[model samples]
Structure formats: structure tokens, C-alpha cells
Target chain A: MSQGNMNLTLKVWKQKNKNEKGRFETFDAKGISPDMSFLEMFDVVNEHLISSGKEPIAFDHDCREGICGMCSMYINGRPHGPKQGVTTCQLHMRSFKDGDTIVVEPWRSAAFPVIKDLAVDRSSFDRIMASGGFVSINTGNAKDANNILIPKYDADDAFNAAACIGCGACVAACKNSSAMLFVSAKVSQLALLPQGKIEKRDRVLNMVKQMDEEGFGNCTNTGACEAECPKSISLENIARMNREYLKASLT
Target chain B: MSEKSFFLSSSIGKKISMGLTGLFLISFLIVHVSVNSCIFINDGGITFNAAAHFMATNPLIRLIEIGLFAGLILHIIFALLLTLENKKARPIGYEKINGSANSNWYSRSMGILGSLLLIFLVVHLAHFWIDTKIAVFTGKADKHNTFNEMKEVFSNWYIVALYLIGVGSLLFHILHGFQSAFQTLGLNHKKYTPIIKKIGLWFSIIVCLLFASMPVAIFTELIK
Candidate 1:
């Protein structure tokens, strides 16, 4: 069981498009390096498929360093694999045993239909973001950083929330396919800042209305989304969003 | 949006209503468990019947009982609607999923546990509640005392088994529901949330253990 010669079985979901049915296709991933990233392993497998005159599996990736949030593969029944606080691009093959049969699939949500083998059309997130994930400002140069006197703790929390890369991992991991963690992180990042205060009411109201209309499920506070988030987004953002929504709705 | 549609159409609003109603039902459990504990006084239904009779005859208690029913009804309604909506959110099922890796089983199965509790409630209301509360409401004078009813109901091993299963389901249900209700209300904080979760664990254990022990004690003739 040397670190280098790790061979494994990969059962990947293969879907032609949103309208077509999907099925799991197994591939023999051979001569995989332990140090290689999960996506790199996929690259090796896709290389094998292409060499055999088979269709290359379509997936999404950018900034292979983890910040872009594009590489989403529900590996071994966990979004972004077994590692905590790491995206698929950051996950290493050393986490799995040499003889393991890994299961990989696209994000399963009605709001995020599978566009290809492992890529989903997460444009629903874009629509929700468009509804209100912005702060209004005058047409001028950006304000100086030190001008706004935000508490250090508030800034840190906002930063933590702002770390969200709009990945569909939260929705993928949720039993109900709820986007609360994603939306809450988006909402909290803005709400904690003074700039977000101007349109706080309408922002939450419009964003939530759009969220509901997009067919995402309800949050039951299971904390799965937070657990699966690569950025380590806290469930407190969800509670904060709930409070903000309540305040906006009532007033 | 109008007040009615906001609660009906919005997901967060439905969750908020569920949380509020769930908290109300939780408080009622305190009253219920406390009254049920009176049977432990073991004076052969004297003190137990007195508390039961007072609960039945008091006007304020009757009004609170109405509110309790309303709370229970709302809790059930929202739970059902949300369950259906959540099911629809994932139109296509996952080929393979590991739910336990990310969340506790009870938290994910609230709908199933709640349905079990609802079934238990019907059997329970028929056994004791119809005997006392419904009798008082319908002006029927003769019925068994609350203590004797407990003794009789628990005398049958089958009925006692059902009660334990009901209490067991409630333990897991409350274990998740208590802290969940608070979080849904946006009351989560780093400092306070840990305390809330600890309290919720202890409360669920204490309440469910007390309830579960009742049926076992009666069946074993430990309290009679």
C-alpha cells in the first residue's frame, strides 16, 4: 500500500443535458497519485475516457486553488469530499483508501438542474443575487476604508460571511435542498456593513421572495449546509437572516 | 404582502410560525408533565384526581386548553406543509446520499417523528382525555378517576408498550425541536447558543424520561 499506486473505482453521474435522464457510469481510476487533488483524479479519469474514444465528462472548475467555487463534485456522498472546510479542488486523494469505490454526482436540486455530467446550471443563485445582493451607492470613488468605524468583531463576521463563493455545496448537502446558508451568508455579509443598512428591508424582502419563487426548499435548521460549506460558513448567519427577515416583514 | 399571505406564502414566515407554535406546545408539555407527575403522590388517585378535576373545572385552565389546541393544530399544519414543500425541492432523488455524515438522524426525520407523536396523541386523548376533559365538556358525570385510568391503561402490557414508544419518539423530536425553535427565531448567538443547546438536551432527557418511566412504573405496579 505505497502512497503512489492508488487505484480506485469511480461511479460518476453522466447526464447529457437538463432534459435527458442521468445515470452513474463507473470508471477504473488507475495509477492515481495520493498527493493529487480530487479534481486532478477526475482529470486522469477523463483523460482515460478521451483516449478510449469515449465522451469526456463535462465538469466545472476555475481557480483550482479553491476560492472560485466552481469545482463542485458530490464525492462519496459529501459535497467537496470528506475534508472539512475545503472545496473539491482542495481535496486530496490521500483521504481515501487505495481500493475505495468513490461515488460522485452533480448537485441534486430542482433549482440547480444538471447541465452536463457533473455541472449544474446554478443560475438560480444569480437570479436570487440579482434581486438584492447589492448595496446602493453614489456614482463616485469608493469610500476610504478607515472612514466607517465598524467594530472589529462585526468586520470579522462580515468577512467570514463574505467568504461565500456562491458555491452550490450548501444546497447540495441539504436534505431539503435549502439555499438558506448560501442566501444567509450573502445577506449577512451585506447586513453587517453600514452600506447594507440603506436597503436592508427591501433587500431581504426581495431576495427572500426571489428565493422562494426559485423552488428551493425550506430550512429546517439541520445545519447540513453549514457543515458542508467549504468556507466554514456559520449557522449563526441563518439565524441572523431569520431575524432580519422577521424585522423586515413585520415593519 | 398581506399578513395572511406572508405567513402562508413565505418559507421563513412558515418556519417562524412553526417555531412560535412549537415553543407554545413545549410550554404546555411542562404543565402536562407536571400534572401527570401528580400520580406519583401515590395516594390512590386522591391528589391526582383533585389536580385533574381542578384542571377540568377551572375557567382559565379551560381557556388555556383552547389555546393549547390551537398551538398544537398550527404546529401540525405548518409541519405538514413544510414537509411537502421540502420534499418537492429535490424533485430528482440522489443516487446515493450519506445524510448522517452531515446531520443527526432525528433532525432530518422531524416529519416522521411528528406524525408518530400525532398518532400517539389520538390514542392518548381517547384513553384519558375523553374520560375527563371531554366528559367535563359534555356534562357526563361518571368516569374513572385519572389515577385509576392510568393504572388500568398501564395494566395492559400492550398499551404500556405504546406509551413508551410515544415517549421515545418525543425524546428525539424535542431534542432537535427545542434548540431549532430558538435558532429559527434568529436568537442564535455564539455565547448563548451553546447554553441553549445544553439546556435543550437536559430538558428533553428529563421530560421524556419522566414520561417514559410513568407507564413502566404503573405496569410494574411500582407506583400503584
Candidate 2:
């Protein structure tokens, strides 16, 4: 009640490990600052739990700055919690009113198994990348920026696609739990440039195959991934990947 | 993967299949609505019957009709398979997940909408297609007046209402399915996608309204 601070309740998902069933545990977050990032508020709750001789609530975070793609967990049914175009680390407490019960959960997908409370193993993305999500560039020197001239429009689009942080929010947000947005972003970032053009065909095919093998669902073009993506990755990337896949399969 | 298996195995392949078949069905609807709209000429059943008869007996049309049935069956099969796989992809669901927070209801409900349309199609074929095919093939009806048959069918208020409901389902189905087909085929463009969506929206509304209006018009005796 003093200034901008308020009390809130959080129903955080708790799972011991990958094989265990998860459940939500309620915690009182009192006198939380309206300006605190969502993660910071959770930090306060964890501190409280640890001091009370309780097993501290475990979640994932590396770079609290949102670019690490380490911060994840659904807050109130959204990947990054109700906020558009921001990661959980960037989501501020002011977005929710005091006395509101916020439900927090991990990204639920067969491809993403929970490692602990609020932290699922996103290594499925890594496996997908290993399939064909790269340009086989010779590693010697950093090429000059203008060595291969890319049109500004193409560069911007490639850059936008490259902005995906592998957070799995797209998969988390998708009703089918589709990995199309993530896989497509990986495919588009390379396929747009000449360096990545050599592998465009195989890249899409292999990545898509790996994606399916990982048990991720097919995209129904719901646009949920693009809508909930913290990085604002475009659905256009999925379309680009689809085009790439067709071209690969046909010839 | 081999090219054969690529189209048959990949996630993209499944979607591409869905999109392709969905577009084919949409094209079928275009022809269907156009042929049925002959009723709007207001000359009773003559013009409509001629068009219907030509469609029923034409060899090339019959060939395409087979393809149409194939496409619908394939569409439904792939839809069911994809929906099942989609459900499996998330064995553990969000306890408090918000679907409306991200995507439109229709976009997520393609399976449900498609199922409704399929149910309608069965009754529709029973009412019109089977009888006409039997009559034509039996050589008992040289001048098949399907329009009179339609008129008779629509005279029942419940049938008219059911037709409207079917058309209503078609509207939502097509609204999402139209541009979704383009996206699945990777045909999106920054310049054209917005235009494609706009066209899709109006196309769904107009096509469905026209189809719905036929039953309403017949029931009200406005066209006959």
C-alpha cells in the first residue's frame, strides 16, 4: 500500500524432476515493487522460501536480461505472462494488479521435458539445430560486412529471423505445441543469405525431420507462435521454411 | 529423406497436404456455389436443372468429381492424423493455459469446423447426389431436374435450417483455411499477405452467404 508496492499470490508449478508429476504451490509475494521484473519478484519469493527452511522454488535463469533465452515459464497462460513481445525477465510486475493470483507454469510439450520446477529441458531445440540449422562456413576470418552484398530488405528480414532466442515460447504458445516458428526462424535466417543458400534445401528438410522426430506437433497456421514470441519472430519465417521445404522435395 | 517420403513423412509435408487439399475443396465450393446460384435467375428450375444435368453427366466433370472425392477424403484423413499427432505433442497440457491469448478460435478449431462440414456433406450427398446419380445412370431421367429436387428438399424448414448451419460452418472453415493454405505452401509475402487475408475474409463471408441464401430463398419461395 505504500507508494507502488503491492501484495500478490503466485501459484508456481513444482516438479521434483523429469519423471515426477508436477503440481502448483501457492506462495504469498508481499509488498512487491510494481517496477520489479517478474523474475525479480520470484527471486524475492525464493529468498523467502529459502530463509524459512524450505526447499527454495527452482526455476531457470542465466542472463536475467532476456536475451539468454534462459528465462522461461508461463505466467497466467501466456509464455512470458500476458505481456506481448517481452520475455519473462522483461515482464514487469505492474502488468498485473495486486491481489491477483498469477498462475506460473513451465512450457508443456512432449519435446520439452521438465527438468525441475519451471525449467524444462529445451535441448530439443539444440538437437534440431544440430540436424541442419547452420551454414557450413569456413572458419578462418570474419568476412567483411560488404563481401556478400545482401539487399537491405533481405538483411532486415534475415536479422529479424535471427533474433529468435531459442526460448521455445513459440512452441509453448502454439495450441498444437508446434516447433514451426523456431525451426522456421532457424531455416529463414540462413536461407535468406547467399552463404546459407547452399544448404537451404537440406537444412529445411533435415531440421523439419528432426523436429517431427522429436514429437513436436504439426503447425495448423494458428499464428500463436509468432503472436506469443518474445522476440517477435514473424510467421513469415514459417512460410519461408515451407517454401524451402517444397523446393527441396520437388527437385 | 527421399522425395517420396519427404512429402509423406515430414511435418511440413502433412501441412502441405492439408493446405493443398483444402484449397482444392475451396475451389470445389466455388464451382458448387456458382452452379447452385443458377437458382437466382428466378426462372423457376429450368436454368438450374440444365447446369446441374450437364455437371452430372459430363465425362471430364465426372473425372474431376472423383478427384474431388479423393481430395476430401485425403483432407479428412490427414486432418485426423495431424490432430491426433498434435494432441500427442503435448501429452501434458497447461493447467491454466490461455488459447485465446494467442490465436483466434477458428484458427485453432479447423478440425472441429471441418468435422461439422463433413457431417453436413454426408446428409447433403444423401439428399441430392445419390438419388440423382441413381436416376441418371438408370436412364429413367434424361432431363434431370435437380432444381425441383432442391426445391423439394428446401421446402422442409429443418433442412433449410441445416443447410444454413452447414454454410455457416463453411464460412468459419474457409475463413481460416484460405490464407492458411497459402502460408502452409510458403506463399506469404510482406506485400501480398495482408491483401490475401482481406480477400480470404470477404471470400468466406460472400461465398457462405450466397450458399446460405439459396436454401433461405427456396424456403421462402423467393426464387421459385
Q: Pick the candidate with the highest DockQ.
A: 2
Q: Report the error of model 1 at residue B40, Å.
A: 1.2
lDDT of 1 by residue, B1-224 (tens): 22223645799999999999998999988998998898788787788788888888889998999999999999998888888888899998777788898999999999889989999999999998887866787775345377888888899999988999899899999999999999999999989999999999999999999899899988898887
Give each prediction's root-mean-square deviation over alpha carbons. 2.0, 1.7
Evaluate model 1: give its TM-score: 0.96
Q: List TM-score (chain A only) for every prediction.
A: 0.96, 0.96
Q: Please provide, for model 1 over A145-241, each residue's C-alpha lDDT reduced to its tens digit, 9 standing for 90 to 100.
A: 6977988999999999999999899999999999999999988998999888888777888888888989999999898998889999999999999
Question: Could you tally the backbone clashes for each prediction?
Answer: 0, 0
The weakest ten consecutive residues by lDDT in model 2 chain A span A130-139
lDDT of each: 0.90, 0.90
List of clashing residue pairs for candidate 1: none
Residue-wise lDDT of candidate 2 within B93-147, one digit each (tens)?
A: 8889788988899998888888889899999999999988998799855657788
Tell me what fraction of the real C-alpha contacts between chains A and B each candidate also makes.
0.68, 0.85
Quality of candidate 2 docking, DockQ: 0.70
Candidate 2 lDDT (Cα, 0 to 1): 0.90
